[model samples]
Target chain A: MIDVLYFAWVRERIGLPRERIETGAATVAELVEELRGREERYQAAFADLTSLRVALDQELASFDAPLAGVREVAFFPPMTGG
Target chain B: MRIAVQAEPFDLGAEVSAFTAGVRGAGAVVSFTGLVRDEGGSLSGMEIEHYPGMTGKAISGIAAEAVARWNLVDALVIHRYGKLAPGEAIMMVATAALHRGDAFAAAEYLMDYLKSRAPFWKKELSAGGEAWVAAKDSDEDALKRW
Candidate 1:
């Protein structure tokens, strides 16, 4: 099981901050695809991957990166905090 | 190492004292406090949102990375969530080390990574109404210096 966290507009779009999901996703992209197939909100949240950034186990990771042994995954836009 | 995400303002001196008082072998401490600023006089108020558990993990991860990279002794990261007025402290960082070099560098590195890494969003509430603050290109550039 992996924990998925959404932030900012992603959370606003999905109407949730976090969820626990069991998946066969081997990569971030595959996980995103799994999420996108769940519902319209998920589809809208995962739409336009260019604006989204993914982190695996709290480290900045790309969508193509493998997710093996990763316990947490987060999706958010380019950070704006200082 | 304490990580707080709250709407309440934090006392800088108190935080520094608490951090130093808890950790030994910390000879230097460096801090950076960011305040709400009007970006081009467009934003009046700011509403910050963050994922609760994820935020702690992210901040701790970045702080750990800084500790490893710079040989820091301890670190603290406090960020405010929810609505904040102009000039309010948005976030603060405190890094402790055996030397000033480590403390200062680690503090800055942690700040840079925190800005680009943490999953917090800010929307500017202005006279025109509320709008999401687009990620600034300058913030990305600042992270590159690390």
Candidate 2:
């Protein structure tokens, strides 16, 4: 199972901070597509890909990156830390 | 190197003094603090959210890179999350080196990376409304220089 995490507005929109799910998706993009199909909230939270960033196993990664052997994935907007 | 991600406010004076005292053969120590700005006098507070599992790891990665690249004697990073009042410190960075140049450069590098690369976000609560602070294009551009 991959633990999917969300933060900031994404978490607010998704209505939960995180969840664990089993999936057969091969890439992050495919995983996102699976999430987007789950409900309208997921669709809305992911409506704009450009406004979102993804991390695989807690590290920034591209959408096309493989999800094999990854245990965690996070989605959030661009960070405003300092 | 030291990295702290917590909800507790840090004492900048004490942190700097302790960091400086702990460094070996360091001639220069530089520190930078970032405060919660009440822009337009509307911001009452801010909520900083960060990934629990990634924050320390990401910061350690940045600090490690800064230490390696600048040959720094020591480095420190402290970031606070949860509700914060205006004028309160949001974060701080300190670096130690044999000379002022490396210390200063490393401090700047830590700030630059911490701004965009770290897994933290800020939401400002103002009199008018609450909004997430947008990531400036300039912030992303700033990373290219390093």
Candidate 3:
């Protein structure tokens, strides 16, 4: 089980803040594809990957990266680090 | 190296003191606190939203990068979320170093990066209704100078 979290516009679009996702996906991209198929809200929220950023277990990571043993995945916008 | 994101208000003096209490040989401690500003009734308040785990890591990464780029002994940042009233504290950044120059420069740099790169979004609450504030291009330009 992987904890997936969303923030800001992503949450607004998905109508959810966080969820525990059980998946057989191998990578973040695959996980995203799974989400995109869940509902229209997810599809709209993730429609443009170019506008989103992914973090695997609180570390910045690319979508193509493997999710082996990953515990958390968070989707957000390009971080404006403070 | 302290990072916090909270909805409750923070005491500036206490936070700064806590950050510098154990540090020795620090000649200068520079701090910046962001507050809610009244935009002539254009805004009634501000709603700060952030990614939970990602928010901390983002701030930490920026702090780490700033420390690596500048000669600073330590950095501290605290950003608040949820609803905030006018004149309330929004965020703070503190840098301590052996000299004034590094402390000041790094503090400013960290703030600039924070406003533009962090995964936090703020909405301006006004009589006109809440509107998500877009990322300012000026902030992006400011980061380019570094």
Candidate 4:
């Protein structure tokens, strides 16, 4: 099981902050595909992969990054911090 | 180096004084503060959200990089998350070095990295409604320079 977190508008669309998902996906992109197939809200939140950024185990990661022993994944729009 | 990610407002004056006092043999100290801008008359307030586990660590990593690259004597970063009114301080970065050039460059580098690399996301509340501020392409381009 891996903890999945959503932030900002992604959380607003998904209607939650975090969840624990049990998946056998090999990569972040595959996991996103699985999520997009789950529900309409997930589909909507992930409609445009270009606008989103993913972090694996609290470190910024690419979508193609392998999900080997990662325990946490966070999805959000590009950061607007300063 | 000191890094703080807190929901409470910080006293900029006290922070600067404390950071400066701790630095030894530094001839120049530079500090920058980011404030919540009203941006016309539409903005009512701002809400900042950040990843709990990654915020502090990410900032410290960036600060460490700044210290190494600029040979800074000391560095401090303090950022607040939660509701903030217009004109309120949102975050601050200070760097101390043996010369003004390094201090200023390090401070700018820290600001550029903090703008995009940090996990913090900001949403602006306005009369029209609330909206998450989009990350500017220019911010990403700014990081390429460093």
lDDT of each: 0.86, 0.95, 0.85, 0.97
Cα displacement (angstroms), candidate 1, residue B33, comes to: 0.5
How many pairs collide in each candidate, listed in order?
0, 0, 9, 0
Q: Which of candidates 1 and 3 is the stronger one according to DockQ?
A: 1
Query: Residue A48's C-alpha lDDT in candidate 4?
Result: 99
The true-structure Cα RMSD of candidate 1 reads: 3.4
Off by over 4 Å in 1: A1-5, A14-27, A31-44, A56-60, A66-73, B20-27, B40-42
Ranking under DockQ, best-scoring first?
Answer: 2, 4, 1, 3
lDDT per residue as tens, model 1, B9-125: 998889888988876988898889999888787778799887665678888888888888888888899999889888889999999999999999998888788787787888889
Second chain TM-score, each model:
0.89, 0.98, 0.95, 0.98
**lDDT value, residue B36 of candidate 4:** 99
What part of the reference interface contacts, as a 0 to 1 fraction, does candidate 3 reproduce?
A: 0.57
Candidate 2: which pairs clash?
none
> What DockQ class does candidate 2 belong to?
high
lDDT for each residue of candidate 3 in B15-81, tens digit (9 for 90 to 100): 8998788558889999999988778757799998887767777788899998887767888989999
Tens-digit lDDT track for model 2 on A1-82?
Answer: 9999999999999999999999999999999999999999999999998999999999999999999999999999999999
Q: Please give, for residues B1-146, the per-residue lDDT of candidate 2 as tens digits.
A: 89999999999999999999999899999999999998868889999999989999999999999999999999999999999999999999999999999999999999999999999999999888899999999999999999
lDDT of 4 at B121: 97
TM-score, structure 2 vs. true: 0.98
- Model 4 residue runs over 4 Å out of place are none
Residue range with the least summed lDDT across 10 consecutive positions in model 4 chain A: A73-82
